[model samples]
Target: MSTRSHSAVMLRRNFKHVARNPTSVFNAVLMPIVMMVMFVYMLGDAFSVGVDYVDYATPGLMLMAVCYGLGAVATAVNSDLTKGIINRFKVMDVSRGAVLTGHVVASVLTNLIAIAALVAVAFLLGFSPSAGLFDWLGVVGLVVLLGLAAGWFTVALGLAAKSPETAGLASVPLVMLPFFSSAIVPAEKMGPGLREFAEYQPFTPVIETLRGLLAGAPSAGDAIAAVAWCVGIALVGYLWARAKFSKRA
Candidate 1:
């Protein structure tokens, strides 16, 4: 069979594994919802961004949801590796790229589901967005790019880990970075040192770009920076994962 055909098989296998795990589903879907509720109700009125706090916070919440949803990619890849399934696949002549492709695609699909659910709940909670058709398309495109970048990066981490437990923690930093970004608070509001970090971090451009898109005023500079960062991350992740897979598996 062709590599694409093999990838499809692997994809189905990975998808089934994730679907059978309730924890994975909760992390991808419900975690975001819970965070959204907590942030909106607990601190919504405390902030005074130019827009409503709910609207101000949605972009950040979506980003956290994406980060949380993708943690399983590393776990799944590590599970196959630690269980010797990768060696079995090798003996069976499975394409290496196909195996990795399966994990990456499955991860992205999980995040897509999580994003959809988050957006729906956001609407119910009065999260108003001003994006037009093109803006919405841009948002989806940017998010998918991020997922691809994160998916491949996590796959590399998974391949490098000695166990699935370590791999499962690979995405924790990503999940936490939004808090230090402009997602929940403006960079200007932060202390001098932290404000600098907040302004320069990758997630800042991402959240800024997304927020601008949703607000109907996408900044050319932030959008360019966000896309550049995503492309760079994806490229780096692809090379690293391929090298690690070749070396180890």
Candidate 2:
């Protein structure tokens, strides 16, 4: 079979697993909803500073959801690795790259769905964006790119981990990164040291770009930086994961 066919088959397997066991999807959807509510109601007034906190926070929450969802990808890949599914595939006639590609594609799809659900909830909670058609397209593209970068990185982490538990734990940092970024608050509001770190981190530029696009004030510089970060991460992660998988096989 062609590599594309092998990937499609593996993709269906991953989707079936998601259908059968949906705890990961539930967590991905729930985390953002809970965070959005807490941020908007508990700290909205203080953080609003004239603009609606929901509006200010929705982009961050969306990005956070995508990042958090990477845990599921890590866990799934780790499970397959530790359980010898990858080894079994190696013995069969299949494209080696398709195994990782399948997981990455499924993960991107899952994150997109999670993002859609989060956006729906945000709209219900009075999070309105002034963006037009082109801007919305840009938002979609940004989300997919971010998902690909994060998902691929998690795949590398999963393969590198000695156990599934370690893989899940390894992804904790990805989930926590938004807290230190402009996701929850403006970097300028942070102190000197933290502000510098937050401003330069990968998540910040992505969040800032998303905020700009959704708010109808696109930041060309931030958007470019965010794309560059995603591309760099995806390339590194793919190469790392491919090397690790080959070594294991």
Candidate 3:
């Protein structure tokens, strides 16, 4: 079979698998909503910086939605690995890039849905953006890119994990970083030591960049730093995942 044909076949198969699984779709949207409510209500008042707590939080929550979608990708990949699907595909005329891309696309699509729902909730909770349509699109684009970058790492984690449960359990740090970073609270409010650390963390740049974009303000150098971090993580993760996939196959 041609390489394009093989890729198309793999993507179709994966999409069908996801579509048939109601639980997967439900959790993708549900988890982000729960987290947003918990943070906005419980921590909103206590977590003030200069910005509106929820507005500052919306970007972080959006990132967290991406993070969770990637974690689900980890679960799906590990499940496939455990079920011998990877080996089955390896023996066939399969394109590894297609296989990876298919999963990544599914992950990005899922994150987009979750983000939309989260944004709706944010809007109902008095969250408003000064951003224009283009700016809104840019924020969406950034979230999608964030999902893709994080998906690479989760894919690697999936390949490395002993089981699906283990893969899910291993993603705690990715979920936790935004809370400590400038996502929920201002860097200045954190301890001087932690504040310094959060200032330079990967997610901080991402959050800051998106925050500025959504606020209709100019972004600082952090935007470049965010792109660098995402691209760097994606490259490293893809290399590691490919190596691991080769070994497992």
Model 2 lDDT on a 0 to 1 scale: 0.89
Per-residue lDDT over 28-146 for candidate 3, one digit per residue giving the tens place of the 0 to 100 score? 77788888888886768976477677787898888878776556678888888889887788787577777777777777777888899999999987798899888787787778778
Question: What tens-digit string does per-residue lDDT give for candidate 2 at 1-249?
Answer: 899999999999986776566678676777788888899867788784457888889899989989867777888898998899988888897788899999899888888888898889888889889999999999999999998999889999999998989998999999999999998889999999999999999999999899999999999999999999999999999999999898876
Candidate 3 regions exceeding 4 Å error are 1-5, 15-23
lDDT of 3 at 106: 78
Would you list the clashing residue pairs of candidate 2? none
Residue pairs that clash (backbone atoms under 3 angstroms), model 3: none
Model 2 alpha-carbon drift over 4 Å, by segment: none
Pairs that collide, model 1: none
The TM-score, computed over Cα atoms with residue i paired to residue i, of candidate 3 is 0.90
Residue 36 C-alpha lDDT in model 1: 88
Better of 2 and 3 by TM-score: 2
Error of 1 at 2 (Å): 1.3
In Å, residue 243's CA in model 2 sits off its true spot by 0.5
